[model samples]
Target: MTEVVIAGIGQTRVGEFWDLSLRSLGVRAIRAAIKDSGGLQPQALYAGNMLAANLSRQAHVGTLLADFSGLAGIEAEALEAAGASGAAALRQGYLAVASGLVDVALVVGVEKYTDLIGPGVEAALATTTDSDFEAIHGLTPAAQAALLMRRYQHEFGLPADGLAGFVLTAHANGAGNPNAMYRKAITLEAYQKAEMVSDPLNLFDLAPNADGAAALILTRRDRLPRDFPHPVVQVAASASVSDTLGLHNRPEPLWFAAAQASVEQALKKAGLSREQIDLFEYYDAYSIYAALSLEAAGFAARGQGWKLAAEGESGLQGKIPCATMGGLKARGNPGGATGVYQAVEATLQLRGQAGANQIPDARCALIQALGGPASTAVTHVLKRAD
Candidate 1:
């Protein structure tokens, strides 16, 4: 396999973006990444997105975006994996470059959550679940997460506010991120008093679906310009795994089996030990998911993932820093665009360009994106080419 390095990365600010169309957001990110890559052109493009078909009445977005971005001649396609759509597209770009199928591959994740209003968004979110079993029963992603949180709290004998730490930490980190949706750090008291979106899950517990896009340019390390301006951040390893889409079918609904296996596979492929992972960019669309991911990734013992957050062990200077760029909770979930954002954010950390969120001596980062609980898990290990 060829050495695939992230030559360039770009992203739109995460927010409602009511004025920006999906194509606009995606093309802006694409142009930025192309410019950042020192004029390297892509032989192929992969667009990751969710809800566009249902909400925007638009399908074939890959071709649509390609034409809109003025790259209609290039091969382009859209990848979808529920919320993990962005990472899935990214994986293809990585393979395209690594396999020598293309000298340069462009990957972009874009979503327009504000395209519609009212119950339409909820209906679209349910598209990721088992329509017959889950959606038919009116169980949405939030409702599903609420069920999981309740189960976790019961089985672990945790208090109602046990997950507060994860929420607080994400917001605290997001406060320092300029591209984050919510730039103000939230307080414990504020979290406690926040309105409940789903019972046992308040507004702060879930990441708001927003409109945003992120892009990355990938190529062989040797292909970079002679004087690349930044440190080399390579995709050391990439692995994706899947399990039962419907949460009810899993043996232990609380345990994210796919998430666990993806991380393990990524670690093995990277030839690095768990202790060497300096940071993690977890798909923290919900706080409970973050807790479960911590346990599943081997960072904490079973039924004890929440403790790491409670003890501030996942903070910037903790045993294993996580969600360093606010994560989905504070960064605002860009639907399918999240995985590309994670790659971009992780690359920043590797390049020592995260500004206030920089982790000292950071080298290796594990980034994971999950689709519908642990139904689909895409994990990647990023290392600074030192």
Candidate 2:
């Protein structure tokens, strides 16, 4: 089996992009990635998108995106796994290259969520949960996350303001990222006083649904172009796992067992331990999700994740440096584009192109994506080839 390397990665500026069409956003990211990858045209392309049908009223997006990128005739496919769509596409591309089916591949994840207004977007996101059971109860994504947070607090004895630090940290980091959606640094007071989106989770605790795209060009380590500007970062492992569609079906409703399992498998395949990971790009659709994911990934004890945030241990200059890009909380969550954005940020860190957000001498990074409160989860580990 050949080792898969991320030859190049790119992402569009995240936030409300009322002007750019969905196709244009996808093309911009793809072109940037292709140019970054020494101008190596991909033999195949894969895209991850969600809510195109609801947001744009368009289907058969693969052809449209390929045509826009000037690779109309190339083999292109689109995938959807609710919120984990982007990571799922990247996992498929990694398998294709690792299995020697394709020497070079392009994977892109994009979403134009702002096309729909408030109610429309809410309705679209509701489809990710058990439509028949959960949706009937009018449980939005934030509501589900709130329920989980309530459970986590009850189970873990977490303080009412425990999650405030996480939100504040994300906002501070996001303020430094020019591409972030919410760049204003927040304070503990602001977090406590912020408008409540749900009971326990406030407005600032949730990621904004934005429009953006991200792209990654992958190839075998030995096949990279000679003029590649940075050291290769191998995709050492990738794993995806699913749980019951309904939140009530899980054995432990508060814990993300699927995410934990996926992360363990990915770490095993990478031949690395939790401590070996230098940084993490955790899915932060909500602050609670970030805490749960870190616990599931073995970075902290089941209930100790909030402590990591409170102590500034997960900041860019922290011990583990999780979500240096501000994660979805501040960076904006463009549905399908988030996982690819996470991978791209990790790649930038490894390539030493992360500007002020760079993690010093980062060699190994872990990225995880979860859909619908961990109904589906995917984890990937990347290592810089010395």
Candidate 3:
């Protein structure tokens, strides 16, 4: 198979961009990635979006973004796997380049949550879950997560504040990420007193919905300039695994079986154990997810994932630095654009461009994206070119 390298990366700050249209946000990232890649034009475009048709009332995002970016005739189409849309699109671009069918593949993850608000936004988000089984009964993502968190706590006999450390760590890390939406650190007391959004899922427990776009340019290593100025970052593994969509359908509701499988497959492809990962950009859309994902990725023992955060083992200088540029929690959940943001953030660390959030001597990075309670789990391992 041909090698796939991330030649360039770009992203807009994660926040409410009421002024920018969906395509406008995508164009900015596309242009920036192109410029970053030294003006390499893409032969294909894979747009990752979840709510263009639902919230923005626009479809054909791939062609719309391609035309807006002045690359109208490329092989363009949108790919969606709920929250994993961005990583799904990136995986497609990786495949296209890896198969030698496309020299340069452009993958863009864009979403404009501000286009709709209040009930509309809530309704749109609910679509990611099972409409008949989950959403039909008014179960939203936060509620779904709340149920999982409650079950996890009951099974593990955890305290009410068992997961506070993840929030603190994300906010503390976000303080160093200019692109993050919530850059200020919050005190433990602040988190404790924060109002609840969904039962046990407090305001601090869930990531706020936001608008943003992130892009990456993937090409064969041989196609890059002989003297590429930056350190080379290549896609070591791309693995996606899916499980039952409805929560009730699964025998184990909170296990994140798909995430575990995806991580295992990604690690196998990269020829490294989970311990070899320098940093992990996990699917921290919710606080409970960070805990569960650690276990699924083999970083922590089952039901003990929360202890890693409590013990500060997830800090920048600890066992496995995570969310180096802030995660969805502090970065603001950019709907479908999140997975691409993970890719961009992980690429930054691998290239030594993470600034204050940089992990010491970082080289290998593991990034995962979730699509509704791990129904669609996408995992990727990135490595600095030796």
Between the candidate structures 1 and 2, which one is better when assessed by lDDT? 1
- lDDT by residue for model 2 (1-386), tens: 78999998888999888899999999999999999899888888889898898999977777788999999888898888988999998998999999998899999999998788968789899999899999888988889999999998999998988988788888888887777888888878888788888898888889889999999999998888887888889999999999988898988887889999999999999999988899999998999998999899888998998899999999988888887888888999999888999899889888777888888899999999998888899999999888
- What order do candidates take by lDDT, descending? 1, 3, 2
Tens digits of per-residue lDDT for model 1 on 147-247?
99999988998678889999999999999899999988888999889899889999989998999999999999999989789899999999999999999
lDDT of candidates 1 onward, in order: 0.93, 0.89, 0.93
- Across 304-330, the per-residue lDDT of candidate 3 in tens digits comes to 999999899998887988877879989
lDDT of 1 at 73: 96
Candidate 1 stretches with Cα past 4 Å from truth are none
- Using all chains and alpha carbons, the TM-scores for the candidates as numbered come to 0.99, 0.98, 0.99
lDDT, residue 120, model 3: 82
